[model samples]
Target: MGRKTPKSKEKLDKRKEEKALLAEHTALVNKANSQTNPLSSFPAFTKFSKNGLDVTLDCKRVADMDESLIHSIFNLEKENMKNLYDECSWGWNDKKKMEEMTEEAARYLMAKNEAGELVAFSHFRFDLDYGDPVLYCYELQLKQEVRRKGLGKFMMQVLELIAFTSNLHKVILTVLKHNPAAVEFYKALKYEVDETSPQNSVFEEECHYEILSKLNKKIFKT
Candidate 1:
């Protein structure tokens, strides 16, 4: 019997070229979409002050932020804030993927002292596709040196006012279950969890996060 003939090399090469072209086209489309996407631009200055501590909140507008500023705020050498949050909260440190997190972050708020050192930061976002009028707190980080000075509370108030004035209905955040102090702090701010958030249950690998929410609709009479 005659042996079956093999396919020509030219045909195989042509198929490979076609696949490569399609892949390249897809990548271009995704890049275009990402570039055209409208990211929320925050004001350069958002000031928060109460009692005595003075703080200035702002967004990191420059693509390349100062390393010392980040380190002073987070006590980490990394340039990306998301990686620091992951390491501190979840113990999953992947610096390379930090840019992806920024794309998801709708708004970033940073607090700095009078000496020009970053003290705290907050990452909040509106859902990209859900169209729900809610703001989600992606992460909230305060430098260890300033944690007990009521700065966190002031930051929360700033976020709350921003959410209310922006016509949002609610603001939601999550805290590790084991972090009792954080949980208590939210409670002091009148945040309550519903059926969606439970107590004494593991919500994440390294930590159990309790989803806390605060509604913006006025509930009291003047």
Candidate 2:
């Protein structure tokens, strides 16, 4: 082949740079997945004590978690989200939600009260979202008794701490627009709409969910 033009060569170089960045992000996620517990490095964060809540948190893979505990978590999600989910285009499906909860990459940050009762939990995974490694929070469900008592905020802080410390790009989660309380809770945490969040358009129906994210400014700014 004849020698390429400067512009063509620059384009090739840009593609190579993008490919390398994607590979790096994939590796970061793999490294995070290999860990038994992301919270191990931060022992102080494993306990929440305040607002009439006393709970100990632990991170475990679904494979390692007990079946009964998984069922409890599923029930909690169904209880807290079924009505709100039914309001959206994506109606509630028991099988689908349970499957998502037990997906191979799924990990749980579980909180148990003084009597060892399961109270609140966050389902999260380390994956490359839009080509950037992120801790995608699939679910954050708390029992009604534990709501508004600061435990939820504390749980999010723990997720952020693990994500940033693991070198992930950000912690992202989707909240339903109709769930004003959830929207306000994330707002209080300073999470903003992510670039990948969808918008209404003539081509598609309006979206009921908003993707919110908090980036690790120490590393992946901009």
Candidate 3:
């Protein structure tokens, strides 16, 4: 091929730049469209019977949750997270951030015992990241006393069920590297670091947390 003239080369480069910009814009639009409004379809509450214990599961818009209740739950987990993450790195004191997560676009799943005390809770959102629809789990926390009663696994199963029913491609979450037990727990449920995870792109650099995901098997069925 002959060497391109300066004007021809300039035109080709401009076209290439335009194409790249358009592709990026298209990806953003797709991601925005993938987000779901969970409150529109999910029930207000559901009940479960596990090991003879009666548990009630309820979903609430973040803004609707009592401020005291939200503070109390976060306080309950504060110490646990401190042990797993740097004290300064934890955002527990950032009330505004918490409020943002609990807003209308988010979903809170509260698990109550037969006596009506809160036993566990999970905060999640239906998000579109990088052109894929994901059920992103922001937090899953249980009272220390209730940790061994299988509540965590039960709640996760419920979350996965919701993801599948809502047509999400996968359930995604982040686990602190210092929290090996949490990592193992997710591993038991078949969660693995995603191929798109930032860890996969870096060269020998360790991340503070691992972005793990489990595909929705139902989404693939014919």
Candidate 4:
């Protein structure tokens, strides 16, 4: 190859400068996202009456959760998962995943009722995907007793608000194909199958799950 002309060298230098600036901007954005906390000012307990029952719920980080809370969460999961998946593939007694135990401990949100009963929990994390910051919800489970009292929707609304406050681009989750109720629940909340999901393609018929996401419009309002 021949040596580059001065004009070409100047263009290369400009491209390098632009790339460096973009990298810096991305790093700054990630740092700011990390610093944002949705529960920063949240109260220790929130009181409300739902379905003729007075409820007081509190949120706790996974690291702060005690053994009793963890066990109760697992019990609730076992009870609920059975209704969604077949016994052949369900792993109720399997070891807890690292994400559930320690790796992403701070991201887990456990809500307990006034009587200190574990009522619901959500596990979520901040992620960067498709060139945007996203909040990925790995799990959201509610005890059977609280199923239709608007608690499920209430928890999800809280998660959406958290995503908005944390500057996340969207909230994303996956539902098992066997669970039509869950699919409908998410649909009712305006979550749709993501365009990028594998199931969106005609050839990917073997996919066993659907990924759903809702973009955070609060970020655009400003």
Candidate 5:
């Protein structure tokens, strides 16, 4: 798609249109990131009380978070994800994982139970991904006790709400193929294989993960 000769007006117009759309996508993502709190819009969504589970949810950047809680979530993530990560092309590296989780750009959506214990978390960021404004979910890990009480579903719903409310084009995540339960969970939530996901013909047996996304119906993705 290299431009050779500057000739036709149609080509010029197409280039202008593409540039304008890219600017809109970048601006939308920038605005979402500039917000004080992504969760601030929906106050009622901060609480989860259903199926005998009661907890409070809050979003904070990794820098503003307490050190202990950061470590706690890191431990929880390792507990829940290490083996799954190990079984795939991405073997778990403690230092690398920690660095990613604590990066300045990272934000956490944390859930705490009645006793004020950290139970589940979703690490996400609002940004321009693959030329689209998206809320990229890095991790969604829950403690064993909170696994099936609809808490995981609730947390995912919160992520979707945040993304759509901020006008992000979609919510995206990567899930390992070995984790059947997790794969099914996203499918149940109506997420489909994203265009960016790997093709079987390309990687064949080496491919270990799938990228999934749910689009904002309000936004038409180009």
Candidate 6:
């Protein structure tokens, strides 16, 4: 036998109905948004494949990349990642972790060769600090063979297009002090460094980062 008061019984019934209605409403809203807007779904995946180069805006697909090519870029194994971790010291994440991180990142660009071998990759996350949305590039790398071939600029243009199409206000990236070439590249593209270091800036580990931003004229045009 169970003891139940009238007020408690009514409240419980009401709560159950509310929960069911809320779940149904959420499903309907999601379905309608997906149908109405393409971006609301899985965002967008754009690919640029030509002569010897192929560029794509995706991350999950990288896991399916050929093992041989992955090894050529950088060993996708834990042992090698450990060596990289020690050298980087900032703590590099594992493959599973990197995949997860990349998924959360809103935008990514991967450059591959004619053989479908990934040569360069870049990952960016959307930041909303500047009223409108802006993308912040967190990681960018290219294999040796692909360097000095104007591929870097092509990747940057792809990233810029992604940001513009997404209606973002600007694109931002932080370049570490070690990479002089990247710094020069961004400078050539008119990206400026915002050097507002904190009071405790003497630490060697706290290397200076160049914060660069490029506005989206399409979205901001008057």
Best by lDDT: 2
- What stretches of model 2 exceed 4 Å from their correct place? 220-222
TM-score, cand. 5: 0.93
TM-score per candidate, in order? 0.60, 0.97, 0.72, 0.76, 0.93, 0.56
- Which order, best to worst by TM-score? 2, 5, 4, 3, 1, 6
Give the top-scoring candidate (TM-score).
2
Write one digit per residue (lDDT tens) for candidate 5, span 37-144.
788889999999999899999999888998899999999999999999888779999999999999888999999999999999999998888899999999999999
Residue range with the least summed lDDT across 10 consecutive positions in model 6? 32-41
All candidates' lDDT scores? Answer: 0.60, 0.94, 0.72, 0.68, 0.92, 0.56
lDDT of 5: 0.92
| Ranked candidates (lDDT, high to low) | 2, 5, 3, 4, 1, 6
Q: Which pairs of residues have clashing backbones in candidate 3?
A: 62-102
How well does candidate 1 match the true structure in TM-score terms?
A: 0.60
User: Which residue window of length 10 is worst by lDDT in model 5?
Assistant: 1-10
On residues 1-222, what C-alpha lDDT tens digit does candidate 6 reach at each position? 778899989999999997786665444333322232222334443455454556553443234445464444343223323444445545566675445433533344566655666677765555543333565666667776666666777667766765666666577776654557878888888876543322235565565455677877885575
**Stretches of candidate 1 exceeding 4 Å from the true structure:** 1-45, 49-52, 60-90, 96-100, 128-131, 198-207, 218-222
Candidate 4, superposed: residue stretches over 4 Å from native: 1-37, 42-45, 82-93, 96-101, 200-205, 220-222
lDDT by residue (1-222, candidate 1, tens digit) is 665346666777888987786665444333323431112333423666665678887754223355465445344223434443464645655553355344533455678889887777776665411233556776677876667677778778767776655545567887766667778888998988843565564663443566788877753223
Clashing pairs in 4: none
**Which ranges of candidate 5 are over 4 A from the true structure?**
1-8, 202-204
